[model samples]
Target: MTHTTASTTAFAPITRAACIGGGVIGGGWIARFLLAGIDVKVFDPHPDAQRIVGEVLANAERAYGLLTSVPLPPRGRLTFCATLEEAVRDAEWVQESVPERLDLKQRVLGEIDATCPAQALIGSSTSGLLPSELQTTLTHPERLFVAHPYNPVYLLPLVEIVGGRATAPATIARAKAVLDAIGMKGVVIAREIEAFVGDRLLEALWREALWLIKDDICDVETLDDVIRYSFGLRWAQMGLFQTYRIAGGEAGMRHFLAQFGPCLQWPWTKLTDVVDLDDALVEKIGAQSDEQAAGLSIRELERIRDENLVGILQALKTGHGDRGWGAGKLLGDFEARLAAQVAPAPALDITAPLELVETRVSPAWVDYNGHMTEHRYLQVFGDTTDALLRLIGVDIAYVQAGHSYYTVETHLRHLDEGKLGEELRSTCQIIAVDDKRLHVFYRLFAGPERREIATAEQMMLHVDTKAGRASPSPEPVMARLRPIALAHARLEPPAGAGGIPARRKETAAA
Candidate 1:
């Protein structure tokens, strides 16, 4: 565990992380950090720790790759440490996810607190344990706080940040920034409470579920159906209170509370009653749960769950108004941040079409006809435009500085159909550029043969986004664009690039 290595010496800003306890949560932290291009050092004595980390990383890789269109940072290194000291040796952030035993957590936290630099923050993955208890044995308790991330921590964005009695305000702020950098939404609990917030609601629902099953009111499968098919959809975006507020209709929350307030005293629920967990009850629940899953392995079930969550979340991101709002807005903001972080293209060969975006058709893009849907082609073109802008020095900062290109007109030609899993690459050829307008063409190709699948011709106008009107682009951006445009003019213009295709020959003949 104490072996020295050369790679440990090159830690940069937010570049390295330490995960102690390589169980589900710990391994998930590793995946999140590693995928964010932060090197991760993991410590766990369990024999299967490496295998667990690998499996979790694989799941995370697949899920995150499909989660966003923004380019991600390069994958970081992952190292397994045999002992806790080595794990903490150079990590800027240390996450302790040991079992919930207070004494054990304290022992581990104390060791981390002693070994890690004072500037290095330590976060506990305790579900309900107070930070007061966790820091009791630590020398630098102010730097330790509760950072409760949801299950499958790599995919879920919520992280409840609870600072204890001895926790410093600065420590909480630092924790929030770190969580945000890793693409997580961190909610800082203003006050410490058992079970935090999310878990408390979840525990209540779980208690009710247990009672339901115990009383034979419904089986596990039915319970799941009632949830996922019912309020579960609402809960994802609007959550409980907001959903109920809408239920109030014209009267709003006041009327809703008045109408349903009396239900609080009704004995319709058995939350106060304790269910006895006899062997027979346990066996019955286990068999029913197994029956619900059929014969699918845990990994298979996890993959399905991750895919469904990703699809729902992505849909939520594109929706607003009546559907509701919450994490989706946050996700959109994160995408913007990711877009901003992308480095400009190293160099461009303007003599040819600028290769900007190379991505495969996502499974979500497949339609009932088993081909890439029509709208997705537009989405890919949009991504290609974003990359084109990035290549010519029009980055997030430039856009935020009160000028950006807005696509004003688009004409797409579907030369050939694209199927699911087909690798699609979009290359941009600048047709013309002026201070206020950009005329561009993009060619979409499929697979290694690079067969032309589609082409998009668009006219983009420089706009003051705040004013919602066209404006001249800045001189610096214009300077970069003009040179690239001049260079691209030398190449032959793409055939059928700028015009919508006329009605097919058969339709005309008919």
Candidate 2:
């Protein structure tokens, strides 16, 4: 049950992880670790555990492949072991995602403590069980703590780290470091509290939601819509407090508290009361949820959800139309890390057009016509031009030196539609280049068949950005570009190159 991958960091210990349970959460942990280039050993005794893990991995790969433009490390190996001992034998970290029975959890925690290496950290993925209780039976309990993650653990960045009295401070610090390396935000709770912070707030909301359903105030769908279509969007970036502060006008939080804080005392919410999960109430909720799903399979619903999430998160990356303020900041930071790690494309065909950029049509790229929108085509062309500029030693440093290429004109022609998830590549051929001007033609091809989706002819002028006018290209840049232009000159000229104003063909000898 051991195989290696192509990409891995030299950071020892954290390179390998053991997941003791392979259900949804455990499989998610496996996927996350694997995607981060950490080899994973998983132990799950369920008969269909492998199948389930495979399915989760597929879904995770689909979602995450579109989640960020970050260049992820090559996927790590996934090994399913027969027992927990085999899984954690040489592992540096152990994540236990077993069911939420206290007795079972205690026994398993003790077993892991006895079996795993003494220095290895043990993280229990318990939603509500206190870390104190879980670590009680451990002989070396200092390494045992809670590292609870949200559902779809691979996509969501938050992990709640709660250390019990027996847990050492260094253990929490190391855990946070490992989690951060894997692109997760580990929020360290100061004390061991039942349910921790996120789950406590989530449980309160759940309780109120159930009470509303029980009282026939709203069905499941309506309640969900109310959150998602309104407050849920707000909560993604600004939490309840900040959102309310904005609602208070320019006066801010103090004014907000004065204006609406008294509403908390009113019977506006059912938080004070509890709802009985009787058969009738349960049936009503279940039936409504089922109806809301409209016979879509769980996998189908999951895909739909992942698509919507990816779209929103990617849009936030651009902060399009000034939306996605706070969440956009996180996306931008993640992309910066990705950009730092990404290696430049290697040298390829010198005698032909260089294929500079490749990307898939994301969910956001789609328009009402069921294909990529017009503006997105321009974005791809712009990105293609940027890629070529980078290849020719024109980058941040070059621009900072007050010299850069500014596109003055572009002629674009759309040929075919690009559907969602279609892989697209842009190829650029140098049409002409001089000291202060460069002209290139680009073709966008998409899908496995490589159908030409669009074409663009661009005219760029070298500019001294500080001077705000056209300028001669730097010698270093010309050194790089001249060879590429020479090599590309041998290829057949691209069709539709440099056509701007329409030219009428002469009628044959009328």
Candidate 3:
């Protein structure tokens, strides 16, 4: 596999990005760029640009909130430039998302070429426009190319990177590096091609869809459902070729080809078919679509689409079943990193107690019981413990390298209930420590009031990930944990909370 790494010596910090339009695609480009922590400057003639951009940002924020594994970094500063020149002046990358007009694209490219630095990379979010056509009038055509992304750019992972004949390999590499840094998947096209890969496939599917609707074989809604229920699921994990490979069975590609080759000669579709946008067909499709989504507004539909996309993509990353197209490779990379840092058992230190506290509960944390569930409380506390351990230098990489700690046993007492949106804190202290085991006590408290909410005592063991068994803590790590545990042991334990609720004699008697 060819891998591209960011050049540490010549890396240019992409702090600012410039967008030439503020329409749907432009706005989405701005959101993704900014949400990935790049400052954005946008220029558009429309008077409603500000309001429209604001709405796009709001939607991007909502979609980002659903991602739990990796947190979205802080949003970059957004600015509305009075002129195109001003927007591109200091930008490392400039994205053109204007209307699909060759003249307009040429004009914009010319203006950008005259203003922006020659070294700066320029990308166009055009679905089918060739880079040659778009950069025809540019003096530095090599710097400009197509970076076609799907609608809702913030959620979609694919970005087709197509370069014209004059396009430099270094520029393509640089663009791919930036996109990869922001968690986007970039596929490089060796030479300029019309429609690119995704668009060509989409065009073919769209042609068939139009034919289906026009012939009255299926309505717009039904055609969409056919894709969503069938090919969409298959496409999510594997593309057509790999999916067909599996269907081919043990016979492999040759056998599969022989079986399906006959279908190629069949009149499956009209290669030169075109559907005129007549009033009757338009009304039929529009009415049916409106009826299918009766009560949903545009925003509601967008939310639904984004939610489903996120769920599918996240599921693919988890490698749940039938390893997805490229998700397995990415997940493998992530898991390798995780394995290198996680310890098999928990290790204790006396000098510094684990930073534990009752966590502030969000609306998403509340269960039907109205109080924080037992599992959630453990989750919050566990996260808090992990954070503290990380601060003390025992991180995922540390644990995965066979030099970390794990919880062997846990004892808890629920003294009070926590309501949604309530502020909570947790306190942890190391009570005992040895070469293999570390015992600690944790107290969860309501913030400010310091009222005890829950108490937990846990025994942690030192573990070696490679051996998959308990082991002695490494000498360096042990030295660090010992001092911290000693210091924590000297501090007075908080008053009020007692043993586990079930073990309380009075409660049991009552």
Residue 403 lDDT (model 1)? 73
Instruction: Estimate TM-scores for all models.
Output: 0.80, 0.77, 0.79
- What is the C-alpha local distance difference test score of candidate 3? 0.71
lDDT of 1 by residue, 51-103 (tens): 99998887887687567766666668999988899999888899999999999
C-alpha local distance difference test of each model: 0.82, 0.80, 0.71
The TM-score that candidate 3 achieves is 0.79
List candidate 2 segments past 4 Å from native. 1-14, 69-71, 89-93, 110-121, 137-140, 267-272, 320-324, 345-390, 394-432, 435-473, 490-510
Backbone clash total for model 1 is 0
* lDDT, residue 16, candidate 1: 83
Angstrom error of the Cα, residue 10, model 2: value is 8.2
Listed per candidate, the RMSD to the true structure in angstroms reads: 7.1, 6.6, 7.0
lDDT of 2 by residue, 25-68 (tens): 99899988987778999999999999999988878877875575
The Cα RMSD in angstroms, rounded to one decimal, for candidate 1 relative to the true structure is 7.1
Question: For this target, which candidate reaches the highest lDDT against the unseen true structure?
Answer: 1
Q: Whose lDDT is higher: candidate 2's or candidate 3's?
A: 2
